[model samples]
Target: MKPGADRIELRGLKVRGYHGVFDFERRTGQDFVIDAVLELDLRPAAASDDVNDTVHYGELAERLAAVVSGEPVNLIETLAARLAEVCLADARVAAATVTVHKPQAPIPLEFADVAVVVRRTREESA
Candidate 1:
């Protein structure tokens, strides 16, 4: 059960929070959808069925919400990077892909939303 042997997906996690540059944008936040895929080894957790043996997806979602909603960020890239960092912090999660969607982006033209995606892996040098 070495690292980077398992995968977990957290898809379409809808979070409403303040994240923008404009004053109005921060005042009246918008909905942000987050999708994440984590690579880890789940053999230990599988054998014991213990939460401690694996990464808790629910906790990961909450941490992402705190980051996305806690403060305002000018770009989704920053947000996505922050999320990637969070995922990599967990030793079990060898790598992660994070996507942040801003369905309420301000624009004159018609569109569904703007989004950013980032993939990160734990570095051996780190």
Candidate 2:
């Protein structure tokens, strides 16, 4: 971890998207729950008490939602990766972990949910 490294988390951000192998899934979009954890230095924000010193989570949420609602993908893994990219777009974010939940997955049996989690560093995203 870098100096003053702390975590900023956004959890349970739900958006409707068309991301799945099945044609029906794409035709009728489903909800995807997203969780993102960002690792970065928070001391600047703490000291200055300025929003500019830290990551603006509300804007981040909007960006992530746009990704989820925009293009269609065949896998949640791709979606998670895309979300990681969005999180790492900020230079302040050293690393990020993104999880995408597919609650209405096509399964033969009953299950709680299906999700994919991806972790990436700023370098990797770049």
What tens digits encode model 2's per-residue C-alpha lDDT throughout 1-126?
Answer: 582269999999999999999999999999999999999989899999999999999999999999999999999999999999999999999999999999999998999989899999987776
In terms of lDDT, which candidate is strongest? 2
Residue lDDT tens for model 1, 1-106: 4545689899999988787778888898889999999989888899999999988999998998888877778888988998888888898788888999988888
In order of listing, the candidates' clash counts read: 1, 0
Residue 91 in candidate 2 has what lDDT?
Answer: 93
Q: Rate the local accuracy (lDDT) of all candidates.
A: 0.86, 0.94
Clashing pairs in 1: 6-40
- Model 1: residues with Cα > 4 Å off, grouped in runs: 1-5
Candidate 1 at 5: error in angstroms? 4.7
- lDDT for model 1 comes to 0.86
Name the lDDT value of residue 80 in candidate 1.
Answer: 92
The per-residue C-alpha lDDT of model 1 at residue 53 equals 94
Task: Report model 2's TM-score to 2 decimal places.
Answer: 0.95
